[model samples]
Target: MTTDQSSPISPYLTFDKKEWAKLRAETPMTLDARDLERLSGVIERVSEQEVIEVYLPLSRLLNFYVGASQALHAATSRFLGQSENKTPFIIGIAGSVAVGKSTTARVLQALLSRWTNSPRVDLVPTDGFLLPNAVLEERGIMNRKGFPESFDTRALLHFLAEVKAGRPQVKAPVYSHFHYDVLPDKTITVDRPDILIVEGLNLLQPAKLPSNGEAIPFVSDFFDFSIYIDADPELIGQWYVERFMRLRKTAFRDPAAYFYRYSKLSDDEAQATARHIWETINLANLKANILPTRQRARLILEKVQDHTVQTVHLRKI
Candidate 1:
């Protein structure tokens, strides 16, 4: 397959899907349809064909990177005459909502765990780090939900730090879409895995400097590798609405669902609400925060319509 020369050359080396697929030769296919179905999110379509063509190669590449990291760590330890704790290789997956980042992270977790070098892989989504609904309401940023400000940035940083420091058990807060809030008393304990995948909307964002010029740490700083899923804003907006409608028919039908009211709405009314939410909140967040961080990712997956990745951009070393 020919490269898209119209795309500007940069620090990134771009490859279309056909060329990228060629790199997957000899990588074992360990996942089946049942695994893909379980990994996929509501309304998200991750086909086996797509997995073979895209994720298999990506997983193999990650395996090589992880192996190299372990080797380097060992060499450093030998030179220092002291054993360093084995830190997890953290991978950050960032993108707009409805861009299928969660699905990508899940698929990677499954694929990477199957590797002999990295047998234990954990996926922690940043949604769990989002401030509770009450906090957003008190801060008067309820309308700005999903924006970077809606998250507990300090808490997220601390959590990642502990994980990278090789903490035995790092507890992460849990968020429930059904309840539309962070579960106060509950937490997900992440043991020191061989690999950790952190997925969220703004994982690739830069740090916000203080007025006094104090340096702040970014979530991306903890990432050994990062991926940004990209698509046209218009397509993402449409996908958001489509996913909303699907949820209205499925999850919203539950009486305890946060969006239960949407399930009762007429089809047209539901569509309107979805469009309004996308345009006012999600789209705004994408433009202001998420999209700007695409260039910061180590890898970029540019998706076309039907939620398929057409090009893969790998940052040059």
Candidate 2:
């Protein structure tokens, strides 16, 4: 394990890839290539090696955390001399766009579900909480679609609150990437599961205070554990552009796609358009909002080129 020499007394314990992989020796590998293909996002690569080295250890660690949390809740219930419902263990995953946050969430969902204790793990993405396209246009922030302001923050908070309160069935709005909008009158029901994984770009951000100085609950306040996926800004930009180009040949080619225009453009033209979007939108969002929350995560997975995690930092208790 390689410790951060600069911050010798920091709260997080850092480990290189090799050191982290050793922690998963007893964990079984249950996923195959076909399973990975279903879980992977567009243009994102997740090899079987990554599943064994990175996700297997992560799943084992999560199992420990979940068991500890359940024990704590049970002890509290006994102390109060009352029966209490078993609340779901929530995990938040945050990262910049194109940093493979979705892929990580999906992979974790699969791995965690295979565990005997947390077989009913569920995944919820914050994209569904985003305001519809018409609402964004009405607010005159269509160009800033992925910004914090573009999300229905209160709705997301309420959803998390209900989940934590042990609601029998909670519904979340459904988001369609092809239409690039939140579907009206559509929702995905989440029954009380053993675990829930919430993935997004800004879940770790602090709450916004009102003029009265009252503090509102942030989405991350409901998270028992959180992870931040880290990578170089320049490399992320490159990956974003590459994914955009790939989509031009795939999803963007669909006639109903929101970004269908890019599919008809020449390769050079498409590349230019991707660069513009990254520079004007995604990159700006990353610098101002996402990167600032890196230290807030309980764990950080730092990736090198070719999208492989080279280091893992786990916050010490």
Q: Summing lDDT over every window of 10 consecutive residues in candidate 1, give the lowest-scoring window.
A: 1-10
Tell me which residue pairs clash in candidate 2.
Answer: none
The CA lDDT of each predicted structure is 0.92, 0.92
Q: Write the per-residue lDDT of candidate 2 for residues 242-288, one digit (tens) a residue.
A: 99998899999999999998899999999999999999999999999
Per-residue error for 192 in candidate 2, Å, reads 0.5
Q: Where does model 2 exceed 4 Å of error?
A: 6-9, 209-215
Candidate 1 RMSD to the real structure: 1.6
Candidate 1 residues lying further than 4 Å off, grouped into runs, are 1-9, 210-214
TM-score of predicted structure 1: 0.96
Query: Ten residues in a row with the worst lDDT in model 2?
Result: 1-10
